[model samples]
Target chain A: MKIIITVVGNDKVGIVAAVSQKLSELQVNIIDMSQTLMHGSFTMMLMGELNAEADFASIKKELSTVGEQIGVSIHVENQELFDAMQNI
Target chain B: METKQIRDTIAMIDEQHLDIRTITMGISLLDCIDSDSHKACEKIYDKITRCAENLVPVAEELENEYGVPIVNKRITVTPISLIAAAATDTDSYVEYAVTMERAAASLGVDLIGGFSALVQKGYQSGDRKLIASIPDALMATSRVCSSVNVGSTKTGINMDAVAEVGEMVKALADKSPLKCMNFVAFANAVEDNPFMAGGFHGVGEADCVINVGISGPGVVKRALEKVRGKSFDIVSETIKKTAFKVTRIGQLIGTQASERLNVPFGIVDLSLAPTPAPGDSVAEILEEIGLESVGAPGTTAGLAMLNDAVKKGGIMACEHVGGLSGAFIPVSEDAGMIKAAENGNLNIEKLEAMTAVCSVGLDMIAVPGKTTASTISAILADEAAIGVINNKTTAIRVIPVPGKDVGEEIDFGGLFGRAPIMRVNQSSPAAFIGRGGHIPAPIHSFKN
Candidate 1:
């Protein structure tokens, strides 16, 4: 199933690089992503699909550790709902 | 997929704020009924729980897959009063409300609606019980909302039911002021409005259905912002064009969903609705359409022009344009309006005057707690007069916040937003409201 990961935290170096590396390692393909800086805070919305052979739990744990290293929060939501929200 | 189109769509979505206004699943509980009220309540609870068990997960999946925000996943069941008609006492109604609240909590929904009674022409035995129990039902529950339809195009106005609602509003507000905030009295309340308290599963609906409410006030406002010095015609055209794009998106999504859910698609309600944000204001659209100010003398005429154009464009965009399909100017929900009200420009009277030409009436307005039931009824009467006279839909959602007076602010959190307490004429119109007979159908209502 596809998933959306919302990365919200301080504007800093290496956030995109770190998140991309983890997803790539887990074999998840990044379908689309956008980053915006609103009122001095960084927010990112990412759409990606899970790798068939990858373990969801392990990837989430790895993402969390990355989140802790950068003082950010990571949230993953199913993509069908994301699309429905956009469409509706 | 066409790579170029996909790239363009992604680019268009990149800079915008998009979120699901609501994902309302309509469930018909008629099949859950039996001769016994107790057994009927159990089946009703089970059926709602079972249908909504996976709604959250499925919604979350869709959210992640598309990178869009699914803000609310709610359910609108068959009106509880209809299913609980077999009850011998008011306790069954309360029991049903409690059961629905519990089921919603189990399903992780924020609110559950359809605690309704259709008493347009007159009240039935069950409708009376349901109406009388509204104060207790609303005060007792945390997430259940109640609505009553007291007038319609065909029935004109039901004075008895309307008077009863006035008292019900007072009792509900007194019980736990917030409960009163959840009650809505409507003239032509829609069956498939995805927006709150009044939405319900009409008899014409499927065993279950999904209706969508698409909002784009920010987009429309920004479009207007582009033409600051443009002529009134161009500004009106801009608003209509933007509304068309938004409605088209809703049409596409609604059709896909109805097809996927294996149910017929309902209407795409093109309400130029607003949130509490600074930029998302339907009133601002009126201002853009050449009104010197939103609550000024020319405001009604401006709204008439805007409302007519929106309908014209939206009707051409979709075959089914139902619900309260017009511009909504809920004062508390629109930041621009709240500011206007706080400044002495917008008041309850002017807002009601503007409703002469708009869609919903006197929405999200907060008056002083001391305002009597008669005055509230008077406001409802005045709005109903406009509706009956003009032959359109109108409604009242007033919150008499206890201990709060004019110029004070009451925060309702979330989508209900916050309202800056508006001034109510301390002078009572008790004499007018006491003349309790039906204001004979406005002469225009006799088109038959």
Candidate 2:
């Protein structure tokens, strides 16, 4: 299963390190990634794949906690959610 | 996907109350009919439970998977009158409603509709029985919702049923007025409406199908805010664009749900339904179009424009669009509407005019407990005339809160919301309503 992880907040050190480390710990593999200072806020988009049996809800909960620890907001959703809305 | 678009979607869901309001499974019960009432009741219960067993679980999984809130998982079946026709031994169909309620409870569905009869032109024996049983059925079950088609553009209005329903509604007030909330009298009621208390699986529909209703008045309002002080053109366009995005989400969810349930996908109802929640309100969208409050001057015109723009915007987003696909203005279910009614800015007269331009008519309104049955029937007649003449759908779900006068309110809690007892027209329509017969369908002439 594919997922999209979005992180947005004021710029700070080790934001990517904390997020990626947490994703790796949860057995999520980062297949693609991008980042930018969008609208004066540090924003990152990470596309990842999860195991077939992995739970997205618990993974999302853990990722958000990691984001809170780093003073940022994180949202994780099935990639299909974005595709369904944006593509057509 | 572009990061900007992704961000906008996230903000819409998180802050703007964008969500798929309901994913209703329409299950036809024609084959479940039996000569024996007990056997028929068993078939009704069995088919509903079997078909919708996975509805709540699948919907919950989808919600967690996509992170989009699917607020309700509901079922609409073939109208009980049609299904109960084979059971001639029974005079009341309350057991049918009880069977549906039991199925809903076991399946964990939020609501079950189609405890209804369509008597627009005339009544069948079963239709009369089902209509007679509606009040007791409503009092007997919590999740069961009932609707009766009393008029249509093609068939005209059934004034006899109208008069009877008025007395029936008054009777409901005598015991538990809240049960009145479960019933709707519709004009030109659609076959595939996914909203309660009017949703029923029309005989024309498939054996089983999935239909979704989308709601996001907050999203449209927020979009309009970005184009504030602009002309009606910009306001209309903004609402259309926002409605398109909101409906796309509905289409996606409906498609996925149908595929997973192994049921054919029906249509996405493009109605911008609202809740009592602070930001999610269709009335607020009208207010954003520049009304101080709902029912103020220009409210009906504003609603007309909004309703048109929503259809224009959402028509292309789904495989098919049906149901009551206009902006809904149910008073008890909308925040801005409730405030307006409480503050004297909104009244039943203005609401009646507004219904001409919107989807349902005189919905979720609470009238003074002393309001007469003839007057209630008169309200139904007025709305039926509007629908029949203009070729639109209108429905009435009024509650005559017992012992409550114009200044009082009924807090139904949750999505049922709270409704202020608005004043009703005191002039007795007893003479007119007392004279019961069919109102002939109007001529579609160029003489207008």
C-alpha DockQ for predicted model 2: 0.67
Worst 10 residues of 1 chain A by lDDT: A79-88
CA error at residue B409 for candidate 1, angstroms: 2.4
Best by DockQ: 2
Name the lDDT value of residue B446 in candidate 2.
34
lDDT digits (tens) for residues B123-159 of candidate 1? 6667887888788788778888788887876667777
Per-chain TM-score (chain B), model 2: 0.98
Each model's DockQ?
Answer: 0.14, 0.67
Please tell me how candidate 2 rates in CAPRI terms: medium
Candidate 2's displacement at residue B41, Å, is 1.1
Look at candidate 1 and tell me the lDDT of residue B376: 85
In candidate 2, stretches whose alpha carbon ends up further than 4 angstroms from where it belongs are: A37-41, A51-53, A68-71, B445-448
Interface RMSD per candidate: 7.6, 1.4
